[model samples]
Target: MSEKVRLVILITAQPGRGEEQVAAFERLAPVVRGEEGCLQYDMHQVSGDPDRFVLIEEWGSKAALAAHDVTAHMVAADAASPGFRAGPATVLEISAESVA
Candidate 1:
């Protein structure tokens, strides 16, 4: 078996457009969480900073994550809100070691 893939994304809404981003994500959550290889898909807002958002995704593997990116829901999410003004686009992607 291969290592799992986890993704963290930090994004900021456009000026005065935080609500738009939030609304879009609300629509996105269910669809993202419904993907076959998705172990988890969570959305959050930064404390005291409504415009700052976070996307946490866990996948069965890198291939699964890649496939999720091309799914219709993801496509709509990107088209609706590009996400983040500036930051590490992908916070991290760790490969868990296999049990020997």
Candidate 2:
């Protein structure tokens, strides 16, 4: 097998779009997990801050992570929030090859 890795996405709100962003991501998770190469898609909120949302993802490979960027759901996630804070989006990935 090629191996697998985890991808983490951190989404920060501009000001007050937290709830909307969370809801948007929530709707996105179900569909994202169904996408090819996606092993796990989970959303998280900061313990103290409601405006910060995080995404935990697992993929089969780096190529899979790259492909996820342009996935229809991603595009929808971008467009889904016609009303997001749109502050910053951080994407980080750990490749299986690096671990071993």
Candidate 3:
């Protein structure tokens, strides 16, 4: 069986553009959640920093995550990011494992 894949994506919006970035993601969450093998795809903003966001995601396997990367919504997001994002996102990927 393939192991689950989890990712923490850190997004920083351009100064004063946080609302635009959040709105864009809000429109995207529903579509992403409907994709196959999407176990979790939730976005959260930093406690005191409106311009900083975190996307927590979980997928059934590496293949599922790969498929997600090329989806239309993702592609559009990438194309539009430069308008509102500070720079490239910081993607932190992790694989499920037994620590005990």
Candidate 4:
């Protein structure tokens, strides 16, 4: 079995489009959370920064994460991003590690 996958995505919306982006994510959240491997899928707006947002996600495994990337809703979000986003999202993969 593969390890779980975690990702943090930073998204910046085009000027004056922050609310629209938030609404878009609100619409998308339920669908994504219902996916087979979805564990955590949450979005948070940056404090005092209306144009910035952060998305945190966790998947059952790498394979599950890969499957998510190709979902119809995800594909549509990618296509619509250019209109609302300032640029491509910054995604950071994460994991818990011990140094001790």
Cα TM-score per model: 0.78, 0.78, 0.92, 0.93
Off by over 4 Å in 1: 83-91, 95-100
Quote the lDDT for 59 in model 2: 87
* Per-residue accuracy of model 4 over 1-100 as CA lDDT, tens digit each: 3488889999999988999899999899999999999999999999999999999999988898999999999999899888999999999998734347
Task: State, as a TM-score between 0 and 1, how close model 4 is to the true structure.
Answer: 0.93
lDDT of 4 at 30: 99
Give the Cα error of residue 70 in candidate 3, in Å: 0.8
Query: Would you give me the overall lDDT of model 1?
Result: 0.74
User: Per TM-score, what order, best first?
Assistant: 4, 3, 1, 2
- Give per-residue CA lDDT, model 1, range 5-95, as digits (tens): 8777777776666687678778888887888788988878888887788888788877888898898777766665665343334566554
Query: What is candidate 3's local distance difference test score?
Result: 0.92
Candidate 4 lDDT (Cα, 0 to 1)? 0.92
Ten contiguous residues minimizing lDDT sum, candidate 1:
81-90
The reply for model 3, stretches above 4 Å from the true place, is 98-100
lDDT of 3 by residue, 11-33 (tens): 99998899998999989999999
- Provide the lowest-lDDT 10-residue window in model 4: 91-100
Number of clashing pairs per prediction, in order: 0, 0, 0, 0
* Alpha carbon lDDT at 78, candidate 4: 91
